[model samples]
Target: MGSSGRRQSRRAVVVATVTPLASILGSGLLIIVPVLERTLGALAVFGAVAICAVAWLIGTVIRHNVLVVEPLKGAGSLDRATLLLGRIADATIVVAYIISVALYLRIMAQYLVRFFASSAPDFLEPLIACVAVALIVALGILRGFRGLERLDRVSVVAVLLLTFVLGAVLLFHDGSSLVGGDLTMPPVPRMNPLEILLVLGGIVITVQGFETVRYLGDQYDAVARVRASRVAQIISAFIYIGFVAVATPVMGLGTPAGADSTLLDITTRIAPWLALPLVLSAVLSQFSAAIADTAAADGNLRGLSRWFHGPRPYLISGAAAIAIAATVPTFTIVAVASRAFAAYYAIEAVIAMRTSNGFARKSFYAVLALLLVAIALFALPAS
Candidate 1:
């Protein structure tokens, strides 16, 4: 490869590894932890996180190596009905990603207002977040993949470092109010099989964005992409464990009244000084995730139609996503994102089973069966 080609490949690796970390850190770890604790209990939440880490690693490896088919590919080879379904499924993935991004931004905005500017209007927070996301998405469209990668590199590192520090502080803090018990070790939750299944379904938000690599075309070879994804998932798993370890012990710390920003709530109780950094990291991660998702959406759309085969398409898709997000309720967005992921996984499993050889084929089928169970479990109301 030429120097320019090498640079693009390197950028592709960084974006692939770090882009999903934004979502993993933002709403998935921060906002979802407390909710999981309250509903499914901490044991179930931890089990789900563990299951997701393993499942994502296996599923990603399979998808990258054998099932590397882009849903909209083979348009001429497939029958009309199958091709149409493929397009619709790919389209759903794009739209589901946007909804997830919008939902995370809305949550991040609430934290910003609550912590930094209590006097700000309720709509103002989300509006500002929407504008920031729009600008980031616009930058990706204008500067292309390299610019987005550079931005994500800086933001993901900062968020990861800040998150680690925050988790450590909570782990070591001596304050009775924050620690609430012996400082030697925090309490651990016990997991059951059923709750584990529930968590398997719930972890879609954390692991969903990694699949965007399928849209990257030939930017990186399969081996490199799989390696990068494994590295990313490891880092993401550690971060998830760190936050869950810190947050679960303090589950008794009061919820943040109306908003769903649980990690923020815990930080406020234990270490008020860290609140600003957490908020900044959360917001930054949301921005990176939104950019990555919009870029993926743009790439997918470009695959399906000439009308979407240019830079402007990214901005259009992103704007539409933001508008839909701003208009829909957060719960509705969550519902759409979860269902879309389940459907996407099912479709991908079918594709993988066809392409994979003996051992790999069996593994794909096993994963597919688990995915079905997780999908069904994920649809149930929290009890």
Candidate 2:
């Protein structure tokens, strides 16, 4: 490849590798976070998100660029801090993904309840949520990373702006509501640390795409890519925190909130104008996330086929999408997706611990242990 060719290839690779991570994070920052702050209390949400941000910048972004590559000859650790910070991002994302899903369980339960109570549940729209999850997973299998990253450039911004506008409108109309509440919030023992760990396990799905950089290998300007990814991850973390920070107070007027009463719930009650559009946007977020997933799955499968020197990757990969769609019933898909995500993150954290630098392995293990405990606690009990 010529110099121009190499640069173009590199850009394409990075974008593909990074996009799904961005999309997932963007969705979290927007639609789900308002409730995160409102119900949890701004300070608790802020604190956890802040810790998450720092954890990600240090762990995943730095790890791959520096530590993962360093096992090869001639690559220096991104600096002395390489091993320590790198593991933090890995654990943070692993934990975050898990928690995101655990939180979603409440919403899924509500929808199921509603469906049961409704007279014409059979007439319900085909499971858009299921379609969304299968599409996302298939995208991961198909698109490699580049496809997802491209989707994120726009999808992330769209979700963010839409969410911000909806949130801002609520604050503008109901400024006084925010001040009337007690700053302190009683904790949901259900969402205690162990459960929180399980919930964050789904958040692991958000950071899944960053692993794409491993394929970039010798082509990347290692230090620079690490820096860029870390910056992106940190900025995303703070933005998520800030969003819930603003949203919770704006929605504080309602009956005490539950997991179902998150940012979207509060908005629907307080600002119908915002709610109507936002509900649509939430669907868009779901759809967009699914599209990106399909794209990623397609690319990955194609690459694997090539790596194994197999024939006609396109056919097999294309079929993979169809297969996912066919096998996973569209209606229960979101719960399935969330559950799958929880499982995936739990596994990833364990892998991260095994792969992390010495001291940081402890951090990864701590989170990993908590997730296992949560599964036994919440899921096993319910079953």
Candidate 3:
């Protein structure tokens, strides 16, 4: 290929990568710091690393399926068990996407309301979220996300730039404090190993967007999708780990309130000037993610049932998300979404095991599946 062709190919891959990358960082970027600090305290970076590692492994399973199971199904070579499992996986992903739509809108609502009125009533957030879901449904029904999808590139780039800037500022602050002989670690939270494990499992939703690649087969070939998924995971893992590491030390400045806007509070203390931009990025990321997941859920529902044609899936998903946003606490919504996605990943692992040939590969998938099963069964909301 010529230089122009190579550049175009690379650009296409980057565009494909933005979808999953934006979804991964959307709500997670705003929430992960607060959750990790509250759950693991001074050891928060390690917890961040652990979560990113598990997400990468799950991404591996998804990429494997893109390469293996997709072809098997395409050729009508999948066995009955694998085919059944694939159907189950599709249903599970739809549930996960619904919960995530609620999650993204809920978090976005919190940021929007709190940014305007710090003491906004609790009910206001859910109301705004419901309104946003309704808007998405209307748009989906009138016109699909083709135009709005363009926002993914803009939002993801803005988010990545803002995140790296925040990370850099925090790192500089920490370094100056250390050089001034005033750096102090945050107070460590005392939780039993089981509690720690449960909290870890619960936050899996923070890294849940890599699977978005699996549903992008219509837009990109399997090779491009797999490449995009892997690249997105690797890039997000580094960003998550680095942000957690730099921000954890300053967490000692104040106790995290365990709310969706906790990161905003932390940023206010360190870099008040950056707070507005961060909130803007939060809003963009969350809304774009909600759009992506709502569209994905609608598509999956259509695929699963003949009755779900046209805007019916969008209406159903929007209604469910509104109900969830109204009734469920934000952290509980996060855990529930995490478990639903974990269940989907577990089933994908089983499909990989059934279709792939090597004993080592099968054993690897079995272990990952078991871990995901445990996550699905035991993940709990952070208290």
Taking the tens digit of each residue's C-alpha lDDT, what string does model 3 give over 1-383? 99998887787788889889988888888888888877888899999989998998888899999998888899999889899999999999999999999999989888887778988888999999999999989999998888776789889999999988899999999999999999878777888989999989999999988888887888888888888998999999999999989998888434444322368877888898998998898888888889988988998899998999977899899999999999998889999999999999999999988888889999999999999999999998888
lDDT of 2 at 231: 52
lDDT of 2 by residue, 1-383 (tens): 79998777667545543443454453454334432332244444554474365346324633443455456324553443434444443443333332232223223323343333435343232343334344444444455446444445665566667766865675464455447554333343334655444444323333333443433445565554564455556556665565555555444433455433334556655665665455555555545554444443444444433462333433343344344444443323333344444443344454445545778765855575455435423431110
Higher-lDDT candidate of 1 and 3? 3
Q: Which ten residues in a row have the lowest lDDT in candidate 3?
A: 252-261
Rank by TM-score, descending? 3, 1, 2
Candidate whose lDDT is highest? 3
> All predictions: root-mean-square deviation over Cα?
5.2, 8.3, 1.8
Clashing residue pairs in candidate 3 are none
Query: How do these models rank on lDDT, best leading?
Result: 3, 1, 2
Candidate 2 lands at a TM-score of 0.58
TM-score of each: 0.77, 0.58, 0.96
Which 10 residues in a row give candidate 1 its minimum summed lDDT? 252-261
What clash count does candidate 3 reach?
Answer: 0
In candidate 1, how many Å is residue 363 off? 6.8
